[model samples]
Target: MSQRNRDAKRSAREALRAQRERDRARAKRKRTLTVAAGVVVVLGAAAGIGVAVADHGSSGGSDSAGRVIAPKGAIGKDSLVIPVGAADAPSTLTIYEDFRCPACDAFEKTFTPTIHSLEDSGAMRTEYHLVTLIDGNLGGSGSLNAANAAACAQDQDKFRPYHDVLYSNQPDEQDDKFADSTTLLTLAGKVPGLKTPAFTACVTGGTHKPWVKKSNDAFNAAGFNSTPTVLLNGKNIYSNASLTPDSLRQMVQAANKGKKPGTVTTAPSPS
Candidate 1:
């Protein structure tokens, strides 16, 4: 072949090889991108499934016929809770309260009756976050003393009744006498099965001190600015002039409506 023709043919062959290499590189990049996108989609699906499973598992089972109650006596230093309704009843409510606050006392007297009835009827579950803000205000020892006593009561299974009576007999917020351990025991005596020396030992020895501290820690963690904060299914329930039995009931109903078999939304109660 002529030299010029040979050179031209060789150059054309090199160009074709280069083009083929470029094509293969492009295909490889496309495959890599496709696999990466698929991986992202799979990860997203896995995350969503994980969340759904968590929600389902947390809710437990269904209780269409009656209430299933779970009372966490004090979730924080200033929070108390009595969870009721079906474990699968579709809602969890939290009440952040102080033992010495008159407003909380009033709430106990006026609105809590309805709540207790609902608890009795299996409509909703309740939780109390017992806070000690009143202590600072009252020159009193705060809810800590009462919380310790209450935890002691829990050890003896007297928590619920003792709780009722404590709120029922709450003294002036400024007074320190009504909330001490001695008085708490005196008041606790009103509830049968609560006065055993065993229970007394727990209270005096501070057996349930950790539970009280847990409650206090949670209160600070939740960033609570005041006492008597009510959270329905993790949403704040206002307690001031805005609070009424009707309004509170509405929140309960709302909580129930959104509840699935095993999930809880934690919120603060309104001030």
Candidate 2:
């Protein structure tokens, strides 16, 4: 081959090698960026989960009596326990739940039937303690408004109905769903017999603030450190798969084996 040809061929080979190096570098940079982006996403997700866990730690909640019903539905200075059954029932179960807590929602949907069955049978009474576990940092403004609205509904004799709607239609704990007063009022309308004006007035006027505060205080007093904490018959119900319907029934049956005539069930298994 001529020297010029040889030199041209050599130059082409060099250029090709240079292009290949550039391509390799570009691919490495892309791979590095992809890995970095994935790490960031994983970190963000983990952070969100941690926030949820922290917020739910305080539902430390459920039912009870009219010993002192607040006038005009003001969250009365008097501590109100929203009861599920006759006050004289042998076992008094308390459920501590956060509106934003997904696990609490699960428990409400899953085990509520058992509670209802017991209450219908006059075997138990229940009290609910509402706590605001989710706050602004956790992507919620807390369940504070919802608690107040629910209390206002109680003033109109529709506490249970409003309560059901709140739990059933719980918004995303990580979003702005239940954050506004309008949404709160909208939810209040779902419960039968709820007096919208009074409830809204109570909530807007902060009338139920004390009641919600009192509930939180009471929950703290009761040693609540987590959401969905169940206290049955003055005993804490521990978390266990066996707390399900069949197992709970078995537990009730077992407890009643040789108990007094009025004692139909034992305390909810503590958590």
Q: Give the candidate number with the greatest TM-score.
A: 2
User: Worst ten-residue run, lDDT, model 2?
Assistant: 262-271
TM-score of each: 0.61, 0.62
Span of 10 residues, lowest total lDDT, candidate 1: 53-62
Q: How close to the true structure is residue 224 of candidate 2, measured as C-alpha lDDT?
A: 51
Error of 2 at 132 (Å): 0.9
Total backbone clashes of candidate 2, pairs 3 or more residues apart or in separate chains: 21
What TM-score, to 2 decimals, does candidate 1 have? 0.61
Positional deviation of 215 in candidate 1, in angstroms?
Answer: 1.8
Each model's lDDT: 0.58, 0.60
